[model samples]
Target: MFEQSKKYFSYILNPMELLRTKKVLQVNPTVASPRAEPEEIKIFVFDYNAAQADVRELKTVPECFAFLDSPKTTWLNVDGLRKVDVEKICAHYGIHYLITEDILSIGQRPKMDEIDGLVFCLLNMMYFNEKDSAVEIEQISIVLGKNFVISFQEDAAKDVFNPLRDRLKISGSKVRQNGADYLFYSLIDMIVDNYFVVMEKLGEKIEGLEEDIVRNANTRTLAKINMLRKEMIVLKRSIAPVRELVNGILRSDSDLIEERTEKYFKDVYDHILQANELAENYRDMMMNLNDLYLSNVNLKMNEVMKVMAVVTCLLAPATVIGGIFGMNFENMKWLHTNTTFIIAAFAMIGIPLIMIRIFRKRGWF
Candidate 1:
């Protein structure tokens, strides 16, 4: 666990690695990898309604135009972002250049905006990287159009959309029966649901750290506490703005979001609200943990001091007797006599015994 924590913090210290498009990692664009492993841009399409679904991967940016005007609800899941490809797809889909800029910008805060006929949402999608036992954030920017929704992710492979895609594949499912708004809701709902997963893992770690602090608080424990506090802050930042994003969807007057889908988005709003509360609680708990660590350290220090005081008291009689016997005067009683020396030795040992007995009786360490 300590090793895992060290590795995790190494990633945390480098904010650029977490916030920017992964340009160095090789991830298969067709399969989902951890959020850290996306290198190239890829696009996936899920087009469906109540009757049937068309699922395929696009090799070029222009392929997306075919679904732009299709009667079926179309969801373009862009895995990674190349500036040129993003500009081309956004232009073809009638998306504003500014929204495209937001997509290209990898670190936008969680927010919602309405431009012309499109409703745009940008939020961080949280993932727990099991390999390093860390929380990873990927920015997802979604644009809801007349009959289409486009999701842009900085990572090429990592997402919480498989189950949602599975629902789209299932005939007669609510996702298939509903319009594009419901599909949009499902996408946001999946993102919100993953928030709980990541938070639950954080809660478990917090609980574990609390126990560890109580049992044995050490420097490593302090490090872990600091690390957790940092993680909590990140979670809070990512989660707090999302409440507004979800609420914006609920309060949006965009025609892209139909009346019937408001309830689904409302459900998502409730979930984000719950996640927000959890983040706040974790933040408070982290502060409490720091205090607890200091208290424990002080308590341990006091224990050591108490033991030293008791030992010093026990040795005081011996020190005084030895000091008396060392006198240079020839008239000193036990200076040269064996029996007197033995008596002095016994007295030195016996006095400390008595003092210890009295001390124990008084409950003084």
Candidate 2:
């Protein structure tokens, strides 16, 4: 029964201490391998309201153009920016090279830029799990045209747009009934929702860290706090650029982004503000925990020193008398006497007791 219970408990438990050292070194994209295949970008278009238009992924420039030829609000989602095929597809669609580079870059800051016929936006989509103490960051760049919206994701492995896609799949969502601008809003809104979830997880981590530090200070707890604090710093840095970019979009008179969606973007800006506030608060708490741990260590050390000093003070007189008695003094009468050792021993033992009694009377110990 005990063995069975142990197995059950093991299934339900996670070793957070072990997880604290699971450092995933971020890869540098400057040296990423060049693609050999003929350049072709994949595009997924959702025609929710109209006669189910081409929701097909594009492999050729002609196919990409075919999707863009109609008056339909097309959504071109290109995955895997490492391929020159994506570049060729973007060129065919008249997307700027700088924008393509931004899409390919791993650590592009979140920002929005509108030029001539396009509204370009770069943002981060983050996922965090408190239970696992893990976070993943991905870059998403969106370009809005008069009748189309093209999205470029950093990688193909993960996406936060699934919920938005699911929402659009339903019959009555604004994403389906409205224009491409609405789709843009829906995607951004979903990303922001994920941000909220990540923030909640981060808050839970901070609270748990606080409890751990206050109850039982350990290196593992301190290390976790520092790691979380660094993650918060990175998160804050990623978020700031995006916030400024969102603010720029909110204030701009871009033809691609409608004024009606301004309120929704404003709401996103508010969410960014709240996230920044929470991150700042968590950082402060982490700093305090560090200080508290240092102070506790110092207090423990001082306690040890105090006890040692007390012991030494009580033993000092005894040590001095023993030294005197152990000296060979042939001419000194007291030293020559047989009772000298007894007298010295009595003095050695009695002095410390007397001092201790005095200390006790004064409540020094």
Candidate 3:
């Protein structure tokens, strides 16, 4: 046992052996796969008021700007930031260069800033991708001005703002009755509400892992636990900043956020707080799951050791007896008689049986 422990320490202390055996790297690379293609830009314009609404798809920047001067609240939704000259649109709205830069950058953290009567906010939109069985994150940049709101997204294929558009189609919708600020609040509210969907999927995954840890803990399960832990970290990183952003908006003195709309912002803030708390809770649960998985692995190792030790114990006496009788001694009592050989055979058999019985009574095997 001492020699075995010495060899274990030697293996551990050797730098080359440690380097070869340990998994020392963990990374999630951001490069796109070879099969992926660049996405095209899609523009959606919504012009609405309490009395009337118009929705259309625009192909050019000039067409998008046509509704900008209208008295009604106009919302321009731009999806897929690539290949489009965002500077021209920003120039048309008097948007600052820094704000335009933030809009084009795909991975900016959530933040809110007000400049010269314009309110700019950056947010992370998260959802579970069924095809990949992973959480997908997209950046959403919103600019709220005097009579228009422009939203920029990295993907042209999907968004959560469809419900608000559906509501706008109805006559006398609250979103239509209010100004651009209310529309801004509704967009933010929809984004915040979608967080719950992502959280629910995460919760389900955690529960499934818990069951797996209890039923069978193996290398695959361990890898899954680590994956989930990393995902939870990502989720927390995505949410914590948004919570701060919403809090900043709620406390800001910007005139772009009206007094009546401040209450709606507060509601959005509360939702973010709830989502943040849920993320923290899930993180704690993942830590516990990791601990549980390690404990199960150790327990399995202990069981294997017990079985091996029992086998060794059962064979020990028989080996000793056989070794003793096999020695050469001409004058020995067992050397001259066939009975002696028979007695030795019985002794070997009897000793092992006795030991096995004793071990059984002690519940050692």
Candidate 4:
């Protein structure tokens, strides 16, 4: 009994060495912000009006329900998704279950969905971490209501909407004076602007990969290129949806959106188009790099084969002579004599050297 207890203790201490303990340990999920837990959701309401934009934090879903009908354009910024209370909030605001499902699911493609009296837009905002050589993407969902804009994010961390916040804070910023449409455009414009920053970093990575391939196009370069290609693919997936979404928004007659704000959205729409085009170009360039590396490898292999062929050609005569003399040539007594052996050996040596010179002259070496 004591021995069995000791064995179990040892197994617990060193599970890797124990039998039936082959399952891999699960890694913890990455926490994007301090407020990553589901219980704490921070909701900020900013109502844009002719006088001053009133900004306040809502403590309950009831507060949001009460504040949606004000004459000012209200912006509801919800900063976490784990709160079970969000369902009540969504219900109160008339946001459908499908849209709420999209809010909870992070992997949804960047897209826009609209129903009667609401336009739903999902945008992926990414930040590049150079030290880690990775990018972190967060979902930003915009609910454009009649007199309000509701923005939902996965985690309550730093977001690109701060620029719009600053604009609202200042007296002359476009966000302060414009309707919900301009605020919508400003949020999207901010997102698109940040994308360029990420792309510039991506451009730098592509440049580095180019240099790496030229210097030493090894397996590592191939892997790097594959990684970049995947990232570009994701970028394309994210950007392409917005292209159609923005176009739809532009074409639709949403009474919630003011006519003055169309140009701002068009500006963002053009940027999205440019981003999609750039991603395609990068995809092609990375492919070219892959082809370039393959070509280099083939050339190297050909050089190696050429060297081996030249060496074989030089040694062929020597090999044949040695083989003929090695067997018992008893018919000729001179074959066994020292003088004949020396003569045959010299001929073997001379023949190979002549072959070597011929090959060199022909530039085969």
Listed in order, each prediction's TM-score against the native is 0.87, 0.78, 0.85, 0.81
The segments of candidate 3 whose C-alpha lies over 4 angstroms from its true place after superposition are 1-40
Residue 113, model 2: Cα distance from true site in angstroms:
0.4
CA lDDT for candidate 1: 0.83
lDDT score of residue 333 within candidate 4: 60
Candidate 3, residues 1-365, lDDT tens digits: the string is 99688657756765543442232122233532222224556788889889989988888777887776898889999876753557778888889988987777645668999877788999888888665445667879999998899998867566888789899899877998899999988988888898899989989989999999999998678767866776676688788998878888888887777898999989898999999999999999999999999999999999999989888877887788778877887776656787987887888788879988998899877
**Positional deviation of residue 182's Cα in model 4 after best superposition, in angstroms:** 0.5
lDDT of each: 0.83, 0.72, 0.81, 0.76
Pairs of residues at least 3 apart in sequence or in different chains that clash in candidate 4: none
- CA lDDT, candidate 3, residue 349: 83
Candidate 3 residue 255 C-alpha distance from true site, Å: 1.4
Superposed by TM-score, candidate 4 places the C-alpha of residue 15 at a distance from the truth, in angstroms, of 20
- Top candidate (lDDT): 1
Arrange candidates by TM-score, highest first: which order? 1, 3, 4, 2
Q: List the residue pairs that clash in candidate 1.
A: none
Q: When superposed on Cα atoms, how far off is each prediction in RMSD?
A: 6.3, 8.5, 6.5, 8.8
* Model 4 TM-score on a 0 to 1 scale: 0.81
